[model samples]
Target: MDHQPLVSLITVNYNGRAFLHGLLESLQACRYPHLEIILVDNASADDSVAFVRSHYPQVQIVENAQNYRFARGNNIGMARARGSIVGLINNDVVVDPDFLQPIVAAFAADAELGAVQPKVLDLQRPGYLEYAGACGGFLDRLGYPFLRGRLFDRVEPDLGQYDTPLQVFWGSGAALFLRKQALEQVGGLDEAFELHMEEIDLCWRLHLAGWRIAVLPESRIWHYGGGTLAQHHPQKFYWNFRNNLFLLIKNLSANRLWRVLPLRIVLDGLALLNELVRGKWRHAGFIARAYLWLLAHLPLLMARRAANRPWIARGAARTEALLYPGSIVWEYFLRGRRRFADLKYSQAFTRRLAYGRHLSPTQMEGVEQPYGTETV
Candidate 1:
């Protein structure tokens, strides 16, 4: 309960009133004092706006005129936050009562740590940790985000196995703790992303700026999991794939891009063909356009990367040796286990966890989503 406040927890809501209500209630139960809660509603049609206005009078609200989508919505809320630290928790997630304090303390404990994500449980299945961010997230060489507790759709159960706090390539936005200075230095999440993979883009910018990211095991949150793409929304597919391709074009060095983009493109072609065979026309279009979009907008992405090149190229640290991409990515989709976790320092290696602390009443093993009464 410091006077200036320590962290501002922001949640973006879109047609998920019941879920946001639960999420806010959990925040109400949190032990941290001097916390500011900002709820950005993406033009909900139902009683969501009215419900929060009537019930949660104490929370700050930003009611957008129309759906700005997740990325823009969060960017709006985050920019308005007054605290030095910002907590980006999904509206569909519920945090443990003891979560915020430890996370804030961790930030206070280390000046270099730019961001941290809490251990996340899957609400739909209590015993299984959510794949979105089991103990933080990582990217293989190809820009695929696979959490330590999960690789793709494969999620592991928690049994006090991953008990220690660890550093991660990127923190999960599901319940991420971020430094405001870093956001100011790099700007908030990319509005171009519109959603999906935006957090990775933000973290990579932080890394280039010499900030560290970590997973705080002491804090715990349970996410409903894949709230946006629950059934493959077109916007979801488009943003996830497009932003990933953009990540490569915008962040990777030119030499690296020229060396490996062709293989990645081939993989994407196969994915598009498979989607086309399944009659997922939009999905296929998404994959096809991801590359086309990159091609069309190469000038802009190149300009952005060129602006960043000077900062990275001038860094004293060696950049080429630890830069592992295709091998790590190939393992994520083809080999399953992260090949670099055992290696320690590889210019950029991958790491994942399969454990987290449980907080639900079930006291069960994983990500359980018991909605009390609400249905999907």
Candidate 2:
């Protein structure tokens, strides 16, 4: 697109020999031109090296000294990528033959576009969509994640409802294509986040810097969900819980955090309690450890906030967007709840603030919203 080799499809792999073969084969079979194929192996103990050497010698490869987690693997690929647009594809995905053409065209059409994600369906279940990038991701005020058509872990089956391409807060890293500028600005995925939510964090920083993200419904990919970690895997639980808390504290302002401290504590406590009741003792421990990890890393987060304050705070007073919720009520009830219409708040607040009318008194410091400032 635009006469440049616009896209570099980068795949990250770790011990997925069987899956990797299918991914590579599908990739080689794609019709899209002006693209380079890259594979980043995170020091797998399997015969991945020999397999690549035997079957896919033409593709560029990077072998890490040890197992680099998803974040690091992506970062390494980013550093090595030569194209202006980089496609961060998972080794477990099989994309359509013509997928890259429209994706590259999307970036060419919009200067503000930072990232675009494809609709990922289940490989085993055919038309069934995966939960990873359900109609693009959004953030509640307290750093909890929700999508336009999906929330929590409840995935909505594809009804062909999200067929129109629209701007979203973030893209799923699985089959995402991102502009190079945003990654350079945000400094790639935070190394602190080894696995989950790294793509969202990368897009959040991009948005904060005034970039945009979009979902291309026309482009499709089949994802073998839970390739690296199963749904209830302990490491998955740990990283998901830990990164949620870390990102919330790292991104929000001190004043906003103070305004909703009690509410956040109650919500987190409930989550911990639910885990305990369901006989998921380790899940509860992960939640507690997430808090403990964030508590210990508060100083580092504060230091980061101080440094980036100059970039966004240059001349702006307050940043606002639909993606940034005024309160958790918007998340819990107003979001995806058909019966929320008759609900009325007893106490009235000023203007359009959702649940700010009855804010908790024990709000913590530095808790501004973690919503991306980008338009898309």
C-alpha positional error of residue 18 in candidate 2 after TM-score superposition, expressed in Å? 2.0
User: What is candidate 2's lDDT per residue for 251-334, written digit by digit as tens?
Assistant: 555555555456777878887898999999988998888888878888887776676566445312232242445444453555
Highest lDDT model number: 1
lDDT of each: 0.71, 0.70
TM-scores, all models, native as reference: 0.84, 0.84
Query: Model 1 off-target regions past 4 Å?
Result: 1-5, 231-235, 277-279, 314-329, 332-376
Predicted structure 2: lDDT: 0.70
Give candidate 2's root-mean-square deviation (CA, Å). 7.8
What is the lDDT, from 0 to 100, of the residue 163 in candidate 2?
A: 61
Clashes of each: 22, 9
